[model samples]
Target: MALALAAPLAACGGGSDDSGADQESIGLLLPENKAGRYEAFDRRIISSRLSTLCLECKLEYRNAGARSDIQKRQFEALVNKGVKVIILDPVDAHAARSWVDAAAEKGVQVIAYDRLAEGDVAAYVSYDNEKIGRLQGKGILDALGSRAATADVVMLNGSPTDPNAPSFKKGAHEVLDGKVHKIVYEQDIPGWTEAEARKKMAEAIKDLGAAGFEAVYSANDGMAGGAAEALKSAGLKNVPLGGQDAELPALQRLVSGAQTFTIYKQVRPEAETAAEIAFRLLRGKSIKSLTPETADSKSKTGIPARLFNAQIVTKDNMEDTVIRDGVAPANWICTKELAAACKSLGLN
Candidate 1:
């Protein structure tokens, strides 16, 4: 997760004693790159927006690669480098409390991004995760149709360390507990690793006899890919599967009938919002207008937050959702193997 550091900012003009007299620095620390969006979208958008917002401000970025230790070191590095504003998507939200506390002691402001980190954070920006889970649950139900009442579902939840994971699981359970026959088996995959998800799914298939569950509800698209492989290898076909994060592969899967649905949370606005807030904080301006809602973490209450809504993406709505938003273009999604599927879905 170590990246070559960007060139140092130019020395302040007029040799001012105050470091903020001319050049300012803002840090963006993301949780991991495995999800693809962090490097492909969030980092690029946030960096571009920050440059546009402040010409003299420098952006220092890092990705933890799902390692909390690396993240803690990165956070400390930013603080020691005199970065006053930091946008942090923690690898382990709970472990971030001490980091936030240390940053606060150094007069630093931490804006929790995507994942809500514990401790006294200045702000948080993410999708309504619980509602996202509800959408996921509903997607499974819709795919199941009449069989939903008798369906036993296998739930492949996200990392135990991520704060958002519990909320997603809670929201999904609220919708799925009574609607489906029962949750036949559920496991929280650590670090949100696709390989672990695949291993767990294989174990589920072995124990459940391949026919015990009627559907698979994966917390995100990456894990869905793993579960899909396990299902395919076990020759379990036609069982409904759903996930969040309308990633390109997941969209293609939807077209090929490998995955039933995915939740699309527009990441551009989310990244831009974080950049705007960071710029405001750098200028000592108010972020009240940007954050209209409040959220609670384990260590803090009434923390200002901006939560975006998510949409369920299916083969039927490809044109209206991810395609309309320009998240993934038609050409990018429709490969030679999937050309027919794309045409039949009106994606061409």
Candidate 2:
């Protein structure tokens, strides 16, 4: 899907450049390194596509490691360095607004990537975040089947500072609130950190007892891993867990029947789309026609966005979704320990 430019081309520092003599620089600000995919997949994908799309383009990248202040500083540094476009996965959605506005003032185009930063950004590229949550919710309900009516579940959501967390939580609650016997406990994991999720899960298990909850609604794979750690420590087994991102460990857990399902957003397209848009804007070309969808941001309306679809992946369909599609390599997922399971699943 394409996204029309939300802000005017001129407003984004675009100007006539028939000769293409100027060397353009694009800045990528990622939120954290704790999530392996941000650096391993997202950065590589974005940089690779940018290099292919604009051979001469200079790419400057930084990870905030989930620190809002550090991201703020990084944004300032990029703006001061006069990069043509900045693709930002904000550490704090609301806090990133000022940085977006600041970039606007300098005529540097800002493209909100992965997580939407609330401001007048030139473009936004991400999946339908609420849909991701809904899929997770439905995966849990489906895994539980009729047992959902009698099951107790606990929600371990993402960082409260990220705006997407609320939408995710809201979507999950919509499907889970009245359908389950009890929502034993729910808390937003700060920084979306694995350790925090582990601690919260352990606490929840302790208070509610191992038998109290049947499913875990973890927001992403990192937290799912943490919850798994806690569950293992408590001697809990075969608990249905929902996650997103389809990280390696999560996929492995799904194969082992530890994690029920994960939502795969397919980051390659997202990164490529963001890079394509930034390259066009850098070269003084219009992108209004490329972006077909518009989304509402907290401080702005009609933000041009390329929203991708997210898919639900279980052990049964991993081959068709992530592996067969080449999103995750068979060799990477079918490890030594997972050999038997992989062969049983027809992964080899």
TM-score of each: 0.93, 0.91
lDDT of 1 by residue, 1-348 (tens): 012112222321112122332228888899888887888788877877777787777777888888999989988877877889999999999999999988888789999999999988999999889999899999999999999999999999999999999889998998998999999899999988789999999999999997889999999999999999999999988889999999889999999999999999989889999999999998999999999999999898999999999989999999988887677888889999999999888897
Q: What is the lDDT of residue 103 in candidate 2?
A: 77
lDDT of 2 by residue, 62-141 (tens): 88888899989888877776676889999999998888997798788899998889887999999888888888899999
In model 2, where do residues sit more than 4 Å from their true spots? Answer: 1-23
How far residue 257's Cα lies from its native spot in candidate 1, in Å, is 0.6
Give each model's whole-structure lDDT.
Answer: 0.87, 0.84
Once fitted onto the true fold, the runs of candidate 1 whose alpha carbons sit more than 4 angstroms away are 1-23
How does model 1 fare in lDDT? Answer: 0.87
Instruction: For model 2, name the residue pairs that clash.
Output: 2-291, 2-292, 3-290, 3-291, 3-292, 4-291
Write down the worst ten-residue block by lDDT for model 2. 1-10
